[model samples]
Target: MSRGARFTERLDLLWLGATVGVGLLGLRLIHMQVVRNQHYSELAERQRTQVIAQAAPRGRVYDRNGDIVATNQPAFSLIFLPGKAQDPARLAGLADSLARELHRDRGELFERLLEAAREETAIHLAENLPLKTMFKLSELKTLYPGVDLIVEARRHYPYGAFAGHLLGYMGKIDRRQWQRLKGKGYRVDSWVGRSGVESRYEDVLRGVDGEIRMEVDAQGRLRRRLDEVPWQVGGNVLLTIDSRIQRAVEEGLRASPSGTGAAVALDPRTGEVLALASTPDFDPNLLLLPEWDSEKQAVASLPEFNRAVQGTYAPGSTFKIIMDAALLQESVVRLDERVFCPGFFQVGNRAFKCWEKKGHKWVDFLASLAHSCDTYYYSMGLRMKGPTIERYEKLFGLGRKTGLDLPGERSGNVFGPEARKARKRGWYDGDTANLSIGQGELLATPIQMALVAATVANKGTLWKPRFVKRLERPGRPPEDILSEPVGRVDLRPEVWDKVQEAMVGVVKGGTGQRVNIPGLVVGGKTGTSQNNLGDDHAWFIAWAARPGEVPSLALAVLIQHGGHGSSAAGPVARKAIEAAFDLASAKGHEAPAEGAM
Candidate 1:
């Protein structure tokens, strides 16, 4: 009887304990499902959800006439989600598969995948893919869980190689740049401007990027998008370049015998750059190709070189214009004064020969400039010496930067008394004679020479070169860029008149006669810069205008190794003038014949 009672009590205690445990478990379930539901739900959601950034379209580039130069095009890119490939085996397999399709090294791809996995972020595997490769990648997506395809905006240039140096190109951001720009909303895969106007205006062109918050399944496949912030497109840049004039300038350069040089055209009244062209230009679109590395050395040779602001050469006899002005201003030489030139001038027993072997027997100020008599200037240079010539050169803005908006503008060399003194070198009359005639250590950019013509045309005003006409932005007013005056040349009215008349005489029948256009009064100076490495560099600086009105156009043309200024550089300048005034296509309008400088 005692044993049966003990067993019944034990059973009763076990039943009571089981009932208490069941009640406690029910309370715990209620707590998790109600009181702290939001907190625990968020924890689980964070494990399966991710935020992916979408690239923003860069700003567009336009010429002065509203022609689009640079814009955006839709491109297919391979996106890798690192969270799905965190496992070592899965990551290695995915990297190997992507490397084959992308033509990338497997070890490099594996390392990149491993780094992204450690950062718990997504990355771009391959971009700007061809449609055929994109389709192959899409098929690979079925086999690879973390792989995806997305459309992105790729930078495109419409004119191909035209104005390529000025328009610039783009490239993917390296790790160093990403570290600096990531706070500014730039992604690791973001493309940035590498040169030209594109690099100069990167801040204005690079708009803010946006992202999409999405939910993913256990396998890392996107299930549904929770929310998204739309990306903002960048501002629009309008250049001061006239596409027609730019085309003419480029055509002239390409047509030259060297096929390697630079040209610049400017509005004489304002410093607006009508056309800025450099030869051996590149098609920026080609750089976006996957095989670009193979052609990199060839591309760097000539195509990427921006010769307009970057190339500096001796001004040659064109510097005679400065000598003419300096001599007249100092009263060292009169407009009617005559000098004898028998082909050569004797300076310290050294003979400097003129371009014309049998030179002008005797020439006055105007005739000296008109005929580009090297002997006449050589004789006068000895009297002027170093100080006076240096003064005029500095006043004319030689050997200095033009402050053009483009990047990498070089300040050409100006070696005179000061420079020679610093280097403990001697200054001689021979040196002065050479400098006086735009030779020997006197170098200038095409832009500087163009400004010289503009200064003469404007009768003494110097305008800062302007490239951008305006900036157009969405949801904002258009910003117009205006011309800014940097300096002015002060001379007597008669001084300007004499200089202008002599220059006019140049086109009327002198070395630069080839630039002559009908019904347009043209003034120019011919130059044959001596290049030790090759043949002389031909140059012509000129300005054109209608009768009884201010000049409108100014130009500077250079032909590397193109022997004579009048014969080589003159024709190119003539072509530019013809295009500017629409005379090349005009009926019965014939350009003047090339003459000797």
Candidate 2:
């Protein structure tokens, strides 16, 4: 072979090797781009595109008379799009400038931005921002890359602190709630009701959120909305509460010297709560703001607790009514039976003293209730026994949840045989004596007491107390709703008559005389429950007019640390009843049946 031939052959082999290498490289590229394209595309989409959720507006709450109590208002928020920002310094500068424009602390705003950035692909600068600031930020989006504006709905209460406890307040969605609601599409930015009616009706109040499909530009800005689905606003909640009566209860409670207490007024015929008031309430608007430390501290410091359904206190003389019911139920004591009282009764070695040291020589059931004679009830308690008393207590809805639509209701304490054993105590004669007068181990919430009053007013039927009357959606028909009834007891009409007479005497000539309203037939019981650990709790339970009047109103009032039911609690009831009647008259309704003490 010649030298020229050898060189040509070597060049041909080199060309063939280069062509084979190029063919292998092209095959590898095809495998990566086409065969694994979906996996890579998903990875890229995760980095560049994010799914954000929008919250739905909470439902509106209204009084029975169609007055708005709670609603939602439009709010603005500042958001960050990480895909558009190039540097942290620029992000910090934009946040600081925005904070200054909003009259907020720049440092705080910067800290929040950094914190949000750490967890979210795009951080929210501020939630519920003012509309003007949102518009300003939107216009200056060019100066602040990755920063955007979001509009939201915030809960608003127009009545201020009037029915704060009953209406409750919403708070930020916590970690546990976020996890629970994540599957349901709830975001961290969502707010939920934490107490009262708001918490109880959360499902109905939280409306369905909608969606928007939008096309964006390369700069991560929304060019236009392609398809939009409007969000469904929550239903309207109509409560049985009367705002006028509620305001009157608040005013009367505020006028009292006692700083804390609760009052609940109900309609005996339907078991509908007319007015529920808890003193030292906080403004619901405070919860709508972002920084709630100061407002939370203020609420914590005040006696803002909902005492009407939460506070448990001894019943004092009011237990006598329960005793009366038990005696009638058991046939242990007749309505006309007379018991002798000498101001004190001896139970074994212990001498139980009555309210009147020198009691009336002979007292019937009516007179006993009027004078709140401890001796008379003590004698009856000895005959009735613990089991019988407990039976009547349960029947009257004592020591149980009222099942009202509002949240945070407590089951008050009633000591049955099993309960007594659990508490490491044994039933005794003295315990029975104390129990007869509604003291010792017995405790009840204001709503519980109000139910008891209603039970007696209705002669024997017990209606489950209810707050919400109807639920209606915008542009939809209203749906009437009701709570499940517990059961009913049938007491003789004669027994109700006797009990009614005694209760009426309580206001006319007995300890509750101070609460007497002229021309108003007010049947009531006064209770001064002694508290060994603190000041006595004053209590008054009453039903306006007679049973024949269909019990237009039934009420229970409790004044924490208030001395006497006659002086402290009774006046509050009187004022509440008067206001309720006045409210009815103002609405062009006939004057409620009037009666004297």
Candidate 3:
């Protein structure tokens, strides 16, 4: 074949290939533009658009009686979106207009806008807006496109400071917490529960955020609105608290001109906390506010401490309940045993004097308990081993945390060999004498002491203390927070019988007489713990029931620097008991008839 003919054929083939490539490109473009137009448009919009997220409202908190304690109220906030103040030349004029309309300082708003613009963040100019300002913003929304008025959820506690410690408070997540929640929809402005039930149930209370995507021009100005996503609000949380009982107990704790103290009341049978009151409590709303640094510090100081679980102190004579049980349980002491108190117990030349300076000569077991004779307990301690009392302390839920649901619980020192090793001290007989009388290295929290009373009232069963009973999740059955007995006292039923008898005697005629309520059978013990820093800490633990029957409620009351147990803390317990009776009557919790329990 000729060279010219071959070249012509090659040229024709190349032309055909180029034409086919062009046609395929045209078809691909047509398919992308026409068949998948929405897909390509979304891709283009995504390249230009930015998403702004809005926080979802947190869950509400309710009490056991179905009364709302914490909830969200519709609120508005003035936010500075940088895209609205794009032009540097027009920024000051825009800020001046905002200042006049929103009553903010022009210079301050300008600074905020400048910062948000530089950082490219949506900054809150003003929050918790007044109704007048909110209405004005709504009317002038079109005039100030950059100044967005968004409806937000403001946390509201309707009962003021009621159950503040138990309910906890909300605050922005710190740097450390942010690391754990980076992908969990947490942002710089995101708030989390810092303490109490709110902290414990953060996963259940915090809701997912929603966002809206908006297309912006090259100058960072909004061009058009795009895709949007809505938020799913959190579920409601129900606490195991009785509002009436909580108020009454808090009032009782504050009734006295006292400085620091705690009082806890609960159903001994179920370990359901009815009332947990600490005198030094704070209004969570006030603590979470900005520009309230000093106020927050004041509330965060010692006075606001949750003494019910966090305050550890010598339980004083209230600890005698444990001592009595240990001795009776271990068969270390006999009911027929007699001890004579000449105001002091002598151990190797050291004399531990009783609160009563005079002598109660030759008192028996029941009489000794009614009188709170230190000498009798000292004698009992002398018979036991050095670590016996300490071992029993663990059994009685002292020297250990009660496994309470609240945060910052303390496992107070139950002076034993282990504690002695920790403190670098050798065990001694004098320590046992002090331990016998509920003194020296032995320390306990108000909740722990309350558990002691509960154990006795429940006939030696130590139920795990809890604040929440059930979680009321949205569109689901009630989830019961079940808890079993943490421990059980080793004493026999008859031992508890004798111990109950002694406790009854103390309330009826002994140091706890002041806590006795008329027409109710009450069992209690008084404690006056010595304090080197100030006056003695007064304490009282009690339980109330129908005459000659098992108790339904148990309480522990402690007053720091209070003079004497009955004089300072007894009246408080009495008031709470009276309120409990009143609440029972109002709720129609009458005694069961026929064969019912």
Candidate 4:
């Protein structure tokens, strides 16, 4: 009973243990084959598939009359999928081959390849690939698994360096930008706007990238194309820039004696920026190249600097118009008021000299503006003081950003009581005298001075400056951008008329005589700004209109280190006016004279 019973019990226990083991194995099988089927399948699928991102083409930029400003050109890039070729040795060998073929540094290429592997991302070996190299790589693609040639778009500026500052240029997305923009469809190799309208409208100009999925073999060789998501192109931007006027403005800037300056042209009635030009501008197309070295060249003058809205300088006599407005509005000076000038005006212990050494012996208010009498303005500055001067300067949009639709605009300084206190300096009557004549601590951008002329042309209305006129988007209605009046100088009609008369007198027989045309009613002011750095800067601000018509074009031209406004800047204004009005008799326009303010 003892031995037989014990054997039977042991056999039953063994059977129970075997039954439990079988049930556990069956559950494990069910979990593996059914419960996690989709998950395992995806893991297996990923091992043999590769996704290639297709970059969307950037938007096109057009001028006012539909001329191309910036556009995209077809290009090719070499992409390497590090995930497909996970072996470090394989990646090193691929990098060596790419470096040799693409003429790149071997160490840099290997480092980039390793980084891509560590991040489990694709790396662009060569961008804007040459046609011959692209074809060679295409033929060798099957040999280097996970490597493919992809089509890309490069920005192209049709006008080269013309209006380069306004159009801006493209640059590779840096680490900081990639960190911020990766979630917004930006890849590590994405190109972004660096400045100007490109930067200001980056969101609208950037297109969403699409991806192409491909099935591959275990060796990372492509087997077949699976599917692709088409990319949506970016919207087109139409600027208010008139190509003809822009050309004229650029030519005018180049014509200056120093060949380094800025010019701004505006449509006074609509506040449209017809043309904005800066000399010594670099080609935006050059910046699109793979190895741009402008930053490394140590060039004396920065070609990328946008002087039209960024560079600030004393407005010189061009500021007298603002003073005239203030003077008339406050009854500080009448149209017939007279000021005696003997070449210099005494302010405290300092004697401020006029541009005209001999001076206009006795000049009336209108003649004071036309002749740019510094002594007359000095007398007026004593009465106006710093606060009154600042008020009018701000009213004319000086010492502030003009709100131009461009990046890197500098709000020029207007040093008065507040600014002097901030700088721990005393405000003096000499400072007021200097400021009253557009000198001293006052600073103004070319765009702001252009607005001053625009204000006068549009009859005291300060219209908001506009660059973009329309946006044409895919599957959307064309959007028109309208600029509303931002401010107005509420001066009596007679006051504006008297100011206009003085401006006309300037062009007719005084400082700005060179800007006068045969049949055009042109009003302008000349300025020779004192610069401590070098020679005085020449300036001319003007407004042009046909007889009995509203002023259409208002412009300001500033020539750095140029000797005289009439000689260096006035001719540029005339050329711009000729282009604006299509004046055929411009060849017969008067030659600029030296020594005029």
- In the range 1-597, model 3's lDDT, one tens digit per residue, is 799999999999999999999999999999988989999786555445667777788888889889999887877877655553366656677687767766667898788778877766656666667677678766544565556677878777898789888898887789988988978889866788988888998887788888877776544546667878987787778887888778877777777657568899988989989889887777887765443245656666545479899988888777778888778888888889888889888899888887777867888788887878888888888897658888888888887888897778989878877779887879888988888888898899999999999999988889889988777666678788986798888689898988888999887777777766667888998888788998888888998897766798899999887767877787778777887777332222122111100
How high is the lDDT of residue 489 in model 4? 84
Give lDDT tens digits, candidate 1, residues 1-597. 699999999999999999999989989999989988998787666557777788889999999888999999999988766444368888888877877877789998899888877765667888888898899889867776657888988888988877888888887788999999889888877889888888888988887888888776655666788999999999999998988888888888898989888999999898999999888878888777654244533565555667788889999989888888888788888777899989999887899988788878899999998889988998888888888888888888887899999888888888688878888999988898888789898889999999999998998988889889998777789999989998988978878888889899888877776677778899999998999998889899999988888999998998888878887787788888878787764333244433345
| Candidate 3 TM-score over all chains jointly | 0.83
Error of 4 at 207 (Å): 2.4
Q: Kindly list the per-residue Cα lDDT of model 2 for residues 279-329, writing each as its tens digit.
A: 867887876665524564456555546889888988888878888877776
TM per candidate: 0.89, 0.84, 0.83, 0.91
Q: What's the lDDT for all of these models? A: 0.84, 0.78, 0.79, 0.84
Which candidate model has the greater lDDT, 2 or 4? 4
- Worst 10-residue stretch by lDDT in candidate 2? 588-597
lDDT of 1 at 236: 90
Query: Which should have the higher TM-score, number 3 or number 4?
Result: 4
Clashing pairs in 2: 76-129, 520-595, 521-595
Error of 3 at 226 (Å): 6.9
Clashes of 2: 3
Off by over 4 Å in 2: 1-54, 83-85, 95-123, 130-143, 148-151, 211-227, 292-297, 300-304, 334-337, 358-361, 416-418, 421-424, 473-477, 546-548, 583-597
Lowest summed lDDT across 10 adjacent residues in model 3 is found at 588-597
Q: Model 4, stretches more than 4 Å misplaced?
A: 1-22, 81-87, 111-123, 135-139, 292-303, 418-425, 592-596
Superposition-based RMSD of candidate 3 using all C-alpha atoms, in angstroms: 7.1
